[model samples]
Target chain A: MINNFHSLLTIMMTDPTNLLSLGWVDSFIIIVYFIFVLGIGYYLLRFTKTGEDFFMAGRKMTAWIAGLSFVAANLGSLELMGWAASAYQYGILATHWYWIGAIPAMLFLGIIMMPFYYISKTHSVPGYLKLRFGEGSSMLSAVSFGFMTVFMSGINMYSMAIVMKVVLGWDIHFSIWVSSITVMVYVVLGGLLSAIFNEVLQFMLIWLGALIIPIIGLIETGGWDGMVERISQNFPAGDYTHLWSTMGSFQDNPMGIHWTGIVFGLGLIISFAYWTTDFLVVQRVLSAKDLRSAKMAPIIGAGFKMMVPFIVILPGLLGLAVILPPLVGENQVSAMNPHSYNEVLPLMLARYAGPGLLGLGVTALIAGFMSGMAGNVSAFATVWTYDIYKPTHLKLSKKEESDAYYVKIGRWCTVLGVFVSIGTAYLVQQFASIMDYVQALFSFFVAPLFGTVILGMLWKRATAAGGFWGLFAGIGSSIGMWAWVKIYPGALKYIALSEHAKDMAENMYRALWSWLICVIVTVVVSYLTRPKADSELVGLVRGCTDIPSEGDLPLIKRPIFWASIVFAIFIVLNIIFW
Target chain B: MIENKGISIWFFIGSLLLIYGVAITIANVYEMISPSMEKQIVLRELNFGVWWGILLVIVGLIYFINFRPWKKGNNNKN
Candidate 1:
């Protein structure tokens, strides 16, 4: 593992020139970005007089900003490196999430889940759960989610720290500490508002700077047509030539079936969690000007998701055309070494993006890392505030002093979350592939609750017993499968899956199935056992709304009506064209 | 609490559909334009027209597949 890490370190820093050239202008842009983020966050801080203001942007985030922020938040440290690697490695197939995962999930969330979420407007998912399962359940959830925040923050730190080390020619530990502290300052000073504002800045930087990278990669191959031609020679199989199949090399086998599972399964489960549940994302919507605005956040984010192929994915594929030649010889070989996979992007940026563009890309890369780290810190703060702090103080008054104290606590939570995560980053398995691993880990917490929260809102009979059982069952099933994969050879070897596929399924499907089990248990157990009385239920029923409701107008009548039609059109199109 | 006076439901739906359509389209288009692997056939198992046709049919059928309408005035007034 140490040797593996060393090789990765080697590949990550293959280009000394890109490292050397990064200087004052790049530093200036990063500092400017820091100030810009801080300016907006602190400026926005004036509007935050109470806990709600600090936590949810006073629940008045505009639709476009909210939408863009969701994308920004979703686009974490991994894309700063991973997507670029994926592009060079897998071709268009590297980005299947935009279709099978993202598109469906967004529509599902907006149409199916968001309306309900907006109606049952709470500060956090656990707060939503608290309405359903009572206090104890919320606490358990807080613990699990808190774990996720730490784990995810660690991952963000780990990946960005690697990039920092690679690009800045610094030591890895130094890189990790520096990256963590840099992200911590602004996020700690502010909160989600700071995270959200920086996301907007970071995303635009990612776009204008990162998008041009593929062009340079393509240029090295002579142009798009030439790049396509070279890949065609290597990958001549059916659907292989098609737009989505991927321009992969058989000799190299960049990603196999497991890789496919990684793309698709995560889309179904963990990716859904990213889009729907995470506070960093949902909070973006939570801060919306209205429910209408909130609904649009993911939709707008999908726009960026769809376009990312040009910036992040294509470069990875183009790297097959450009960089892979030097590493693997003309015949291409297994991308077993994680660093080799990781280097796919950095090498392209070094070789192709010259001088001014290089500076911009470096700035954007830092901005992207900042956006990711900021989201993690702010999200960690959120869980700390709502679940751990505010709920325990029964006598906590709504006075100005009390509210300010809550906001202060929230900010400090951000600081603690960042520092702790930086320390933990060294241990995370997904250090090499941050987004996929971190998000899948998040699903372990988020999925079990999806069943619990939705049921609590709809089923008044959903007993605390059922909630506990459901949460327990979901976590148990997921963890059992995870352990089985790791310990039981018969389970894993006979499973005949790639490490990537198993990991992806462990993250996505295991949690989804667990959630399904928990949902069934919640309903059946609630029905079988004595139900909560009408008086005991804390939410609106029948025509009466306001069970943590956001008060946004419905996005469309019979939303599934359009959603199904959309699904049908694509299905038929795929059948006919192939 | 703000009043629910100004709203555009189709805009949201349209935006999501456009996002879905465009992103998936690129994946398909990129698949079409690029190669699969060295040892495999070059034609896509899932093509643009087929994918679109099936999608259109599903969208068409979704209008009819019949789901319970989320009732109006379902406010959260606890």
Candidate 2:
């Protein structure tokens, strides 16, 4: 049955026409999408009068709105294109980043961490650092995070340009300008509200657009069983089907990442850091209407997050099982091109989607790009205004400022942020893969930031000095590791299993080492430093903080109930896929 | 008034769905009426535009109705 589907795919591939090219109807659909997005921004502009409205949606978003936006902000071109490309390169092992890498951390955030964040009422993650660890730690966090967000926005811009250039044959520079301009106009005018609203809409469109490919592919290849059979037959050496079977040891996996790296490096450190701490994602949850909604947002996001692999990862597996054989033929060595693998999602869309749906799919891709850029830009603007600019520039000037003054500054910062992102996008051209670059950035910034935050929240003894130094040391160590690998590529052999393993699993080991260094530094420094008084630490540290009790809500509606359900499903998925 | 009523989010969502539906429907109909080889090929495969459009329009209408000031419920807080 799989062979029959393979033959059919081959016949389609033999056709002279490129499946990925955009037709008039498709372009029209994309145009309509843009117009609608701008229309929302214009309409919401009136409501965005106050800084709170612009920065945090006036703190009035329900669980559904905030939850959808929280997940959707993350469902950007990076998640769509980079992960699909990763799937093509690394097989089903890439799903680990989505499942074990995301679910538990999201649950931990909703159940354990949201109370601290929500009750504190801080505008950004760095704001929390300011309250807990004083000026030095907060400044370091704000500066690093400000720089990181702009860089991330630039990466999103670069990824969008690459996809457009490949799929629509658009000029890369032209694509970047159009997308950056579109994002800037809306974000500057309507602020985070516009971004979140578009994110919710994009979430719907993306599912509508991308879901069809895997469904059709599954039908063509005779379901999961057939896909597995076909993949093994075509490429027996490549372990593309199994997820955990390959994860027992570093040598056992196609990803060359051992269970320790997958569970500890990615699952604990990287995932926790991203979901709990990164303002790009956390900002949406922070905008929730109330405490209960805030707590429920990540839980809702986790439920949807666990299912994302089916849409994103399955296409790459299909590409491997069915599409790659015809294009590459039997001589896989000469046919190896990393660039071509990155085009898997676009190629699959071109193959499956016709005129109208084709438009929707392309529009969905653009939406993903725009939302990602907008999320980063908005987060940057907020952190800059409240955390950095407010304290440093505004305070020094000694001029009393109104809420509207900060809102104006937020708008200006949005413009500045997007411009910086455009510059960063050009810098990203030197990198081979966006995924590796993004992971490297996460290691440098997020790992240490999380270490500082976790210790501050759990251990009241963690002083201002410890927080600052621990974060500084963690970031410095990650940069050193990256430089060491670049200068002495053989350094990886000590940590990784083989030559291939060293290259593939470098980010995992770097994250592990950096996180270890951060924890050690923080613990030692905390013991030596003077701690904040118990009164000053109230509602900030875990033991001293009061956890909110569910009021009048039924058993099923409670956060604990939903978390259990999601975790049970998560465990079941791992077992089945194992 | 709309901001005070806290219906912007509802209206925004409704407008998005309605606009998407109308766009898809128009584009699909145009392809059907003045068909090119590309349009014919695309149409022949799986023209989900009209059906999905109609579904979205219905959903949009439901949301739009809920956005009416008279229909504002206890959860409507800005």
Q: Which candidate is the best by TM-score?
A: 2
What class would a CAPRI assessor give candidate 1's docking?
Answer: incorrect
Candidate 2: regions farther than 4 A off: A1-19, A324-339, A429-442, A495-500, B1-4, B8-10, B22-78
Docking quality of model 2: it rates as acceptable
Q: Which ten residues in a row have the lowest lDDT in candidate 2 chain A?
A: A326-335
Cα error, candidate 2, residue B42 (Å): 9.7
* Candidate 1 wrong stretches, greater than 4 Å: A1-20, A216-225, A234-264, A324-339, A395-401, A426-443, A457-461, A493-502, A505-507, A533-578, B1-78
List, residue by residue over A1-578, the lDDT tens digit for candidate 1. 43443344345454564343442233333444445555555554554567776777667666666777777777777775776665554556555655556666776666556655675667777776676567877888887787787777787767676667655565677667655776676665546655676676677668756765665456457786787777776555523223433323322334444433444455565566556666667767777766656656666655556566678767767766555343332244455422365666666666644323444566677677777777767777887787877776644755334777878888788777877787678766334566565665566667776667666666666788888788778777766766676676456433334343434334555655677788888777777778666765534222234433333536363334445555565455334322
Task: Please give, for residues A457-521, the per-residue lDDT of candidate 2 as tens digits.
Answer: 88888988888889889899989988887788887775444455645477777777777788889
lDDT of candidates 1 onward, in order: 0.59, 0.79
**In candidate 1, how many Å is residue A370 off?**
1.6
